[model samples]
Target chain A: MEIADDSKNSKRVVFVTVGTTLFDALVRAVDTQEVRQELYAKGYTHLLIQIGRGSYIPARSTSDNGSVAVEYFTFSSSIAESLRSASLVISHAGSGSIFETLRLRKPLIVVVNEDLMDNHQEELAEELAERKHLFCAHPRTLHQTIASMNLDSLLPYPAGDAKPVSKLINKFLGFPED
Target chain B: MMRENQWLTSMAESNGIAVIVVTVLTLILVRLLYVLNRCGKSLRPTTVKPLSTLIVLGSGGHTAEMINLLLELQKDRFMPRYYVAAATDNMSLQKARTFESSSSSEKGTPAQYMQIYRSREVGQSYLTSVGTTLIAIAHALWLMIKIRPEVILCNGPGTCIPLCAIAFMFKVLGIRWSSIFYVESIARVKRLSLSGLLLYKLGIADQLYVQWPQLQRKYPRSIYVGCLM
Candidate 1:
C-alpha cells in the first residue's frame, strides 16, 4: 500500500510503524475499537501501518471510508519513501527509526522499550526531547500523548546546530569547544 | 578353625586401615573448611587501591578487559593513575588506542597507553624465556624507576612473569612494588601449562584477582573479585 502524493488527505491520514515485538505490545496497550471509532467520528479516511519483522496488527473496520492497512516489510529504500510520504509517524525508539524520522523531518512520537535493562533508549529519548527533535511517551502514556499531539506544529525541523559526535567528545573530555 | 582365625585377623587389619583413612580424611576436611572460612572473610569486596600507579602489563583480551574495568572504576571515588604497557607493534595496541580515545572522551579520565620493546624473543626456548624475562625485567625496572609506580599489574603471560620477577627484585632493593595478578576467567585455567603453573605457584603477586569461585580454594592470597570486566 502507498500513501497518495497529492497531500489532499495528509491531515486525515496517520502513519504508524512499529518493530514486530513492540507493535504487538502497543496494539494490546491501546483500545483499538475506541481508536477506530474516534477516527471514524473525525471523518479520517486511512491508517497506514508498516509491520516490523514478524508483527501483524489486525484491522478494525467500522466504516467503509476509514480502513487500516498493513504493508509487508520490504527493503530500507521503500520504507524510507513511506516515511517521507507520512504526515505523522509513530515509531519505536530504535536508533534507525529515530534517525530516519529526524532525517525525513516527520512529526514523530517515539515509544521506548521499558523491558530492556539499562534504559538506554530512555536516555536517547530524553536527549532528543531536550533538543525539541521528537515527542516521547512511555507505553503507559502513549494513547493520551498521541491523541493530544499537535502534529503540524510538532513536525521536525532541520537539526539546526546539534553535532552528535562533537557533543559526545566534548562531554567525554569535560571541556566544550570555544 | 585355623582358617577362621586367619580370616578374623585379616578383617581386624582391614578395619584398622579404614579407621586410619577416615581419621586422616576428617582432619583434611576440617583443615579445608577452616581455610575456606578464612579466605571467605578476606574475599569480601573491600576497596583497596594500589599504592602507586596501576601499570597493566599485557596485550590483547586481557588488556581489553583491564581497560574496561579501569573505565568502570573511573566513575567512582578510587581514581588510580594507570598506564598500559604493551609490546611495540602489537595489533592490540591499535585497538587500545581507539578504546583510550573513546573512553577518555566518554569518561573524562586521563588514562594513557604506551608500548615497550622486548630486548629478546619471548617464545623461543627455556633459555630464551629466561633471557626475554631478563630483558622484560630490565624494561620494567626502567619504567618503574621513571614512572615510579608503586604497583605493577601484570596481564601478559610471558612478559608478566619477568615483570613480576623484576618487581620482586625491586622489592629486595627496598622499592615497595605491589604486584597484582589478574586471571582473566575460569576458562583460562584449563589453557595454562608448565609456566602458568610455575607463575601460579611462585605467588609473587600480593593479591591475585580470580573470576571463578573454584580458584579461591587453590590460591591462598587470591581475591575472587567476580569478573574483572
Candidate 2:
C-alpha cells in the first residue's frame, strides 16, 4: 500500500472551510505545522483555508520542498466554485457546507464545533460518517482523522431528489397525471 | 295593529336568520369531517385545474433547503407560486425572485413574493412577540384570502406557522381546502423542529415528511421519504 506518494499528483488542493460563523478551533487545528506537513506528505500541494469570522489568522507559508503552499481568506460570495476545484475538503459541519461538498462528490471531512449552539451539527456529521459518506471529527480528533483518512472508502452521497416528494404532493393534491 | 304586525315579522326574520346560521354551521362541520377524513385515510385523487401553490421560505438554511426542494417540483403542476417570507428577511425574497426569474423563462406560472411580519426575532422578548405574532397572523390571513392557494409546501420555518394555521382555518370554515405539506429539515435528527412539531401535534399538515428514519420512528405520523434535498 504505497499510496502515500504517487507521481504526477501535483497541484492537489486541500480546502479547509469554516463556513460563515467563527470556527477558530477548526481554523487553528488545520493551520498547524503538523497538519500541513501531513497534508503535504499525502501529496496535497496547497492548503487553502476560509477562516470565516475567526480571529486566528494563519500566516502564508511554504515548506522547504516548496509544496503545501498555505493561504487563508475571510469569505467568498459563493464557495461552490472553490469547492468544485478542491481535491479534498475539510469543512465545518454546517448543513450548507456539508451538502455542497457532498454534492460535488469530493472527499470530505466534517469537523464539528462543540461550542456552537448544541450537538445538531454533531448529529448530522456523525450520522453521515456512519453511513460512510464522509469523515466526522471533533476539533481535538482532527489531526488523527486527517492522518488515517481513506478517501476511496467514502461513498458518493446520492444526489437528493425532490421529484418524488413533488410527485407525492401532486398525487396528494389529487392531480391526475397528464 | 301595524306595530304588532311589524314585531311579528321582525321575530320571524330573526328566527329565519338563526335557522340559516345553524344549518350553515352544521353543513360546514360535516364538510370539515369529510375533507379531513379523506385526508387522514389516503390521497383522494380528484381533479383541480392548475393547483395554486404557496411556498413559505425561511431565513438561511431553511430557505436554501426549500429552494432545493422547489427546483425538482413539477413547474406546470404548481402554478402561480406565491412565496412568503418574513418581513425582515430581504435576502430570502431576493433569492426567491432570482429563482422565479430563472424558472419563469421556462413554461411555468409567474412567482409572486410577499412578506409577513416576522412574528418573533431570534432574541426578541416573548411579550413583544405576541403583538407581532398577531400582526403576522393577520397578514397571513389577508394573504391566504387573497391568494387562496390550493397547496402549501413549507419546511422548518417560523413564518410558515401563521400561514399554515390560516390555511387550516380555511379548511375548517369550508371556505377553501388547501393541503398543507410540512417537510422537517434534514438538520433535525432525533426530534422535530418547533414548526414541524406544531404542524404534527395539531394535525394541521396534511402530510409531514421527515428525512431521517429515526424521526419517522419517533413520530409515527410522519412519512419517511429519505433525504429530500
Candidate 3:
C-alpha cells in the first residue's frame, strides 16, 4: 500500500510475464498469500507481474509492503528492460517469452497454460525441462515449484548463430563464401 | 437425326477441351519437376555480388524468432535486405526496422520494409477471405518481382506461403532463381505449421529447416537445425 523509495532498487526482483496474451490463472496463483510468502522466504524482495491483457488484476499486498512488494501492469512497450533487471522470471509458456528469458540466461520457470487445447507449449516445456534449460510447472503447482525451486540448476541456453543457417543459404544459392 | 448430330458435336468439343487442358497441365508439371531438380543441384547463380535478401516476418512470435535467428547473419553478405510482413501485423515491421537501425554502424546495406495484405484475417468470413487471398497472392507476386531478392528467408508465417510460392514460380519461369529458405517455428515440436507443410510438401522451399529433432524425424525431408532461437 505504501511505497519505500529508498528500498525500491535494492529489492531482489522476480518478474512474471504473460506475454501478449491473457492468463489470469497464472496471475491468481501468483497473487496468493502462499506464493508471495514462499518467494519472500526465498529472499525475493519484489514480485513484478506483467499481466498483459488479463482481466484479473493482482491485488497489491498491503500487509507485506516491507517484506515482498507486489506490482502489476497490463503492458509495456518493451519487455526487455523489465527482463534485464529481473533476478528470476516466471513466464507463461509462449515461445517468445520463453526464448527471451532463456537468451538472457536467467533462472526461469515456465508455467504451461493447460486451458489452450492441443498446445505445443507442453512439448516445448517438456523438452526444455529435460534439458535443464528452465523449470516447468502448471498454475496449480506453481507455489510448490517456487517453494522448492533451485536457481542453480538451470543451464544457460546457448546463444544461437545465424551464420550456419546463412551459410546453408549461400551454399544453396551457389554463392562463394565471403 | 439433327438432334443426334448436335449432341455428338457438343461431346466432341468437350473432349477437345479436355485434351488441351491435360496437355497444358502435363507441360507445367514437367517444367516444375525440371526446375525442382535443377535447384537441388544448387546451381551457381548468375550474380556474384552480395545477395539481395528477402526476409518475411510474421505476427508476434514468428517475428521474435526471426529477429533472433537473423542476429548473427553475415549482414554484409545478405546486403540490401527487404523485409515483408502482413499489413495487419503492426509490430513486426517495426521490430525489423529497429533491428536494422541498431546494427547500422557496420557495412549494413539499405533495409526496405514492405507490408502486404494478410491472406485472411482472424475471424474473417471464409467467403470473403477468397477475395482477400487472391489480393494477397497478387501482392506477394508483385513484391517478389519488385525485390527480386536472390534469397528468401521466412520462419513460420502465413504470409510466407504466397511469397515462397511465387518465388518458386520465378524458378519455374527461368526468371531469377530466389533460393527459398524456410525455418519452422521452434514452437512446432510435434507437427509442422501449415506454411511449413506446404513449403515442404510442394517442394517450394529449397531448404526447409525444423528446430526440433522430433519434427525432423517426422518430416524426413526437413533438415534439422537445432534451436535457431
lDDT of 2 by residue, A92-135 (tens): 98788888888788889999988853456688888899999999
- Candidate 1 residues B6-93, lDDT tens each? 9999999999999999998897667545433332132224333324455454543455555545454332232345564557536555
Candidate 3, which segments miss by more than 4 Å at Cα? A1-10, A63-67, B1-19, B45-47, B75-79, B105-108, B120-135, B174-176
Better of 2 and 3 by TM-score: 3
- Compute the interface RMSD for each candidate structure: 17.7, 2.2, 2.5
Looking at candidate 1 chain B, the ten consecutive residues that score lowest on lDDT are B35-44
lDDT agreement with native, every candidate: 0.52, 0.83, 0.83
Q: What are the DockQ scores of the candidates, in order?
A: 0.01, 0.41, 0.49
Total clashing pairs in model 1: 1
> What ranking of all candidate models by TM-score puts the best one first?
3, 2, 1
Q: Each model's TM-score?
A: 0.39, 0.82, 0.85
Q: Specify the highest-DockQ model's number.
A: 3
How is the predicted docking of candidate 2 categorized under the CAPRI scheme?
Answer: acceptable
Show where candidate 2 strays beyond 4 Å.
A1-7, A62-67, B1-44, B105-108, B120-135
Where's the lowest-lDDT run of ten residues in candidate 2 chain A? Answer: A1-10
